[model samples]
Target: MNVFDIFWLFFMITALQPILRQRFLEAARQRMIAKIEKSRGSRVILLVHRQETMSLLGFPIVRYIDVNDSEQVIRAIHLTDKDVPIDLILHTPGGLVLAALQIARAVKRHPAKVTAFIPHYAMSGGTLIALAADEIVMDEHAVLGPVDPQLGQFPAASLVRVVREKPLDKVDDQTLIMADMAEKALRQMKANLSELLAGKYEPQRVEELAETLSQGRWTHDYPITFDEAQRLGLPVSKDMPTEIYQLMSLFPQPVRQQPSVEFLPTPRKGHEGGQGTGLFF
Candidate 1:
């Protein structure tokens, strides 16, 4: 082919790539929705967000980062009538704390029982959100990480470097300066974590966990298996089969209306009853 023809061909491929990918994604999403709809027993609303790493049948897989937008979750929750229950299939590395909290709160507030299904991993803020659900279901290989706050690269790494270089006996001006900045970063991160862990853990324990996480010493901290989560005061169960992972990856769509338990509405006009039926779920 001529040089100009080759250039044109490259341009065409680059231009069409995104469009073609988008079309394929949409088709896959439709298939998943169809599958879920065809399943027997119980009504379920599948909530997927765009922050997920993978897109099955055009629908974004569930991710912690995706839940940061409370409005999106609120919209989705509003779409559900008081009649149906929900099964939240989660696979995320975690994201913003406030967003996760908001999602968890919404799930708790809903009338339907929210069951968080972890087919892969739920780390950091993802763990926080999982706590809000009535029950958490995991496959054999699924895991949950600690709810430790991170200070990011520039802050945490720089501080550690300064601390290492400066000895107690002798310290240069630059080293002292970096050390101070690092200390401040660490303090701020700790405080943020403490706030997030309010009512969940004591301040001192939260600090300890935050430090370990911020330091990034281990590849992963508090890597709890499905059984461990149950032992740790979490309502956890093993339901999804391992083969489902392969099926999910290939089909990219979830079967709809699978059997799931619905959350009962809070009663009105009693000791814990100041709200109306409209406020339930």
Candidate 2:
């Protein structure tokens, strides 16, 4: 070939290298997706919430399970018959008390079985939702935390304790009002926890477990291991399916300082044609 023609050929090959690499990456990702899908049984839906990741830009900001999510999942369940099972893949640092309560209630009351799978961490309100599950599967390193409800930025138990321990004259009127609200939140939380444990334990024991969990016996984010959870009256198993790690690999911690996209799909080889053979990232 002529020198100019050879140079042109080399340039074309170099230019297409990135396209080839992207195609390879896309293919690998598709295989992983297929594997995860295959592991799930027929008529099962996986709901995942990874708190360490940022969900939407210019939105409510922090990524945590919320009321809006309850609406979506509940509606999705409504569309299907009661026979389908719901698998919750929970890994969260917890969020609003009421929001978590809404989701826990929906899951608890679902006609079909609801299972919670925790590979790493599910704390505070996350624990509340996990409590509602028919069965909970956890890894040896996995943790389900205290269900102590939070009011505003403070734990309800802490607020209530301060009011009870401190002199009435020393506390401000405004603080007293806040403490009153916190007490109410505590009651609500205890009642909810008791209800969630209804079928799992006796009525008196249900209230006791609820009190222990909601009374700030442990820190809100304290990691209750698999054994600890079982001891505390939660229906938890140490055995977790192998495919969960593959799913968790899909979500990495958020880098708040930088703007980024998790995946970006672009045109590769056959994409240039109307009938595309594959997509690349």
Strongest candidate by TM-score:
2
Model 1 per-residue lDDT tens digits across residues 1-281: 99999999998998777567768866775665445535622233333333433333435555446543566766777777765666666666777766766776777677866777777777866776676666788887789876544454334545566568757467667656666666665565556554544455566665665565444444434687877766655668887743335334543333346735455444557667565665321
In lDDT terms, which candidate is top?
2
Query: What TM-score, computed on C-alpha atoms, does each candidate reach?
Result: 0.56, 0.74
Q: Give the count of colliding residue pairs in each prediction.
A: 13, 0
Error of 2 at 236 (Å): 1.0
Residue-by-residue lDDT tens digits, candidate 2, 192-231: 8988889878888898898888888887878899988878
> Candidate 2: which stretches are off by over 4 Å?
1-61, 254-281
Give lDDT for model 2: 0.75
